[model samples]
Target: MADTGELKQLPLKSLHEAAGAKFGGFAGWSMPLTYPAGVMKEHLHCRDAAGLFDISHMKLFAVSGPGAAAALARACPIDPRALPIGQAKYTFFLDENGGILDDLIVTRTGEERFIVVANAGNADADEAQLRAVASAFDCTVEPLDRVFLALQGPAAAQVAADAGIDGADLVFMQGKETDDGWFISRSGYTGEDGFEIALPAGVARAVAERLIGDERVEWVGLAARDSLRLEAGLCLHGQDITSETNPVDAGLLWAIPKGLRSGGDFIGASALEKAISDGPARKRVGLKPEGRQPVRAGAALVDGDGNAVGMVTSGGFGPSFGSPVAMGYVSVEAKEKPILAEVRGNRLPLQIHPLPFQPHRQRKG
Candidate 1:
């Protein structure tokens, strides 16, 4: 655990404190780990109604200028130039070795401007990498000082409508800019029909208060957020996907359009092409441990004969699914073999389940 004293605070720290939030250190930020309702209740609440989350710790950046899209394309595997206005595409920043540096969402706001949302832990490094990639192009990477919020669940749309934020028409992966300083996206990590809103820090508190004041919306903390996203099969950067994980092995090749698969001038293109041709040594997969015991990360996975196969990266109980869930990487040959996770000096049987323990309810139209 990181020292809370040394962690940076969120802009809404006071608001969270007033709401009975328990603070913890995550990615150098003092963030709310759980609210009064607790992780289980909060997780279930989000699935049933609306759950509001303070995700201001994530880094927001505006990359604009005449060459913005072209330059961004050099850094990411996706072609930002192809992104239509008001649409966002999930993508990754890969190193020269084809390893993922960070996973981010890029929203095309204008012909030459885009908004990037990156993980807090990799914000600084991602910004530096973006600047370097845009150096030769007519682009400028400017960090935004704003408060980001996610309102997610089955009733999220109705809640947003009641809160005076009109997101009723925005389909999944779409975004719209309001005149009131709100950049709203119809997307979330929780695999629910939701909206991620970015607004000025000055108005964040009042806005949060108004939303939570609604009977349908509850304050959800990071702990429940992780469980929610895990159930949705979203990858956390430092854990499921990392500096050592490639798109092919991580099952993220879908992010790359078919047109860019054969060739592109992007970084790691050759390496990624080679990886696709030769196939990855290890592939990320979902694991369902037998029994009710949780199989945590760093636990070694083995074959039926106890041969080393892989290791768990992310693991915990899926509150919505009501079972233990995990994700890990395994050698291609061993991925199909019977697997077991070593927990507390005991080997536990595990089944290879499909990704996303919970069904995604994101709005399609």
Candidate 2:
């Protein structure tokens, strides 16, 4: 166990305390688990209104130099050369054996520069990998220990517009640097309209204050964030994907560029190509529990005969769906019938459903 007091703090730490936030240690940071209104209220708030989240613990980095994009392409499966400026793509960093090191978001900023955002827990490992790649390619990698904020919900666009930022013009996976010295991206974990803002550490506090000043916006915590992402069918690193899993089995084959499917060579390209040609043995699927009981991660997913076929990776009550939902990897053979999840030593009936449990309300423009 880690020491609670020794955990790192975010720029909005004081604000969280002032708002009576319940604290929890997450990814080596002391983060708010929920506010005074509680996790349920915060979860619903993001679905109906706007919810502000302190994502400062996420790692941000910038890669630059003449061959930055090409050099990064060698490690990542995405075709960076085709990614336009101001546009971002969800991709994976793969090991030599084709296992996923981490799934990341990479945005092309210029011919020679790009911005990368990665999970908080794997920040050091990601940085080390990038540094090694840069050294080999003779490029430059700079880590930005900045503050990041995610404003998510159906009313997120209106709130951002009220704050003098026009989110309607920003399409999904697109980002722009605002005059207020913040980089705003039309991306979020929740299946709703939102933006992730990256700003300097010094201005993070003010930005949070300004956004929360709006009556439509409330401060949310990690507890609701997890539920929102799970409802959205978004994969959580180390849980849904890891060094042992390949992208094809994770149901993220669309992320692989068309050109790379054949000739474009990159790290783990051969294995990924083979997996694409020959289907994976198992696949990720969503589960709708028959009763009100919520299944949990690591629970055994069994067939009617009581044979274990898969394991739940993420599971919870989907606030948007108003039911118990889960995601897990099941063998392709077991996908034909209604599966059963072993919850608390009882066989709970479950319907194998498609992903994105809640419909996405993100703006198309």
Candidate 3:
């Protein structure tokens, strides 16, 4: 068994236990794996209605200085110089070899201040990298170990609207502050309309209670979180991406800005440029299993001749789709046709399909 003492607790630790959550150690935190409703039910609930997730374990940091944007550009692949205030962009922290260290959301708050949200598992490394670069410039990086919540689903917009959130004005990848020291972003892991609210520990708990007070909202856990992200075609930090995977190979080439392509002197630009021009040896893709049994991560993919071509990174029984779905890398040659996954020592047929197994019905209208 994993050592419980080594696991960290979020601000809502007791509340999760009170709700009868099944716990698991994720990124050193004692996170809820699932609730009584189970992963399937919670996954469906988030797709159809609103589901509240305690995402407080994610690392929130603020970097401020006269040259903050330029300093950030030195560390990330995105062109922070062009990022408008109140806007956020999903980008990656590239290593010296052009491989991803972590994927993050960066928001420009002021002329000299920006807010960066990193993955919970890579928070320490991300902070260290940021500090190492920031030291050269006259900037201060402050890590906020606060609470965050993601309220996501088709009904998420309505819930936030009812709470006087003016969600219509907040477009995707945009953020605004509420009266209670809360930062609300119209972004989420599920392919649905939602908001990620970051606030102080005390106020975050209160906000969660208020949102859950509504009949439409239900508490979701990590199990559902994984399935939802898979259905949404989003990549998990350690699973879909790692220091071994480049942005291009992970199917995130769009994240590389045009300015950064040629003249941009960011870290790993040369390798990334080479990969962009030559193309990666293998690319990430989606798969739909033929049977009810889910194709889990590490499951091997074989070609028609039974040659190992790839492996599954994330997979599960998609509750919304009513079948098994998966996402992973495949050889460039295998991209044109159907592939098979080796599960339980048997070759199971799988069809290559487009990502986002489920459609996102956000509040765009």
Candidate 4:
């Protein structure tokens, strides 16, 4: 239980409760922690079948009017001007000091319209910054209250298509706004072929229920989401990536386009330029634990001589890999080799590995 008061419930709270979802507090939202099938089973289900997740707690902000894309590019490093219509890019909102404010998925919905899906905990801050930027332009920034859901797994697309949703033709990282007021995107946190839909409030439940009626779909919860994302090597905002972290140190250099990295009018351009020239002393890396015992977040990572170096940012049992997988910042010196994670005063070996502990099965066009 979190010390925070007044945990809000999702629009699908009643639906989740009826399906026996375990409860927990996530960003002031009383969200599902797990379900009757358990986290492990749900995790596997997302790999083999499809798992439905209520992600309405996450914010959806609309930025549009005129020159919206170029207007937004000032704060976000990614060139929204270059993002094609119907395509989405995973990028971060950087502060003036080059620190990551919040990572978000911004999808270009139209000629001048865009929708940003931000992390739940950082939604308020994200919108505030976006509003600050919009005040200088001819655009508007409005937060949305739609019900967001993730249909994740190998069978996610087929099931959603079978249910009459608009996802079968969409490629990875693509979305199209429907006349029914829902935006369907073929992307997910888990490294799988999936779709995330943002639906109107009135039809959210009906759409979700219809999809789950298929034999390939099941209700999942936050626990499975955490493990699935960890296996996918995706960073969890406020954890693996923080306000103090920069994209260079976070191993997300790929998100920075070549032209942007060298010179751009982006918010964090100056500081990121320095980081790129001097090189970040540390980098995010993946670790494979030697045994079945799981390494958890914040576990102390040490060097061979027991000197503290870094800490585990995300760690868990990878059901697909059938091994414990962990990821964290390690000194560049130890990044290419094995290291140790101190758990309960016992140092456990963590072999250095590349990301995506579970292979991604994106259905790219």
Best by lDDT: 1
The worst-scoring run of ten residues by lDDT in candidate 4 lies at 1-10
Q: How accurate locally, in lDDT, is each candidate?
A: 0.92, 0.86, 0.86, 0.89
Q: What's the best-to-worst order under TM-score? A: 1, 4, 2, 3
TM-score per model over all chains:
0.98, 0.96, 0.96, 0.97
Task: Candidate 4: give the clashing pairs.
Answer: none
Candidate 3 residue lDDT tens string, 195-232? 88888887666677788888898899998998898988
Cα TM-score of candidate 3: 0.96
The lDDT-based order of candidates, best leading, equals 1, 4, 2, 3
**Residue 331's C-alpha lDDT in candidate 2?**
91
lDDT of each residue in 1-365, candidate 4, tens digit only? 66425888898888988899888999879899999999999999999999999999999988998968877788688888888999998888987667889888899999999999999999878888899888888899878779999999989978987898877889999988887788889999899999999999899989988987888999889999999999999999888999788998998989877889976877889989888998988888888898888999999899888877788999989988899999999988766555899999899998887898988998988
Instruction: Please report, as a residue range, the 10-residue window in candidate 2 with the lowest summed lDDT.
Output: 175-184
For candidate 4, give the lDDT: 0.89
Q: Give candidate 3 misplaced runs (Cα > 4 Å).
A: 1-3, 164-168, 178-180
| Collision pairs in model 3 | none
Q: Please, what are the lDDT tens digits per residue for candidate 1 over residues 84-163?
A: 89999999899998899999999998889888999999999999999999998999999988899999999999999988
Better of 1 and 2 by TM-score: 1
User: In model 4, what lDDT does residue 64 have?
Assistant: 94
Q: Residues 1-365, candidate 2, lDDT per residue (tens digit)?
A: 34668898887788999999988899899999999998888999999999999998899888888879878888688878788888888998888667889889998877787889999889999999988887877579999767899999988888998887656778888886655556778999998889998988787777688899999999889999999999999999998888888888889888888888663557888887887788888898988999999998999999988888898999989877899989999999989966999977799999887889988888765
| Residue 100 displacement (Å), model 4 | 1.1
Task: Name the candidate that leads on TM-score.
Answer: 1
User: How many pairs of residues in model 3 come into backbone collision?
Assistant: 0
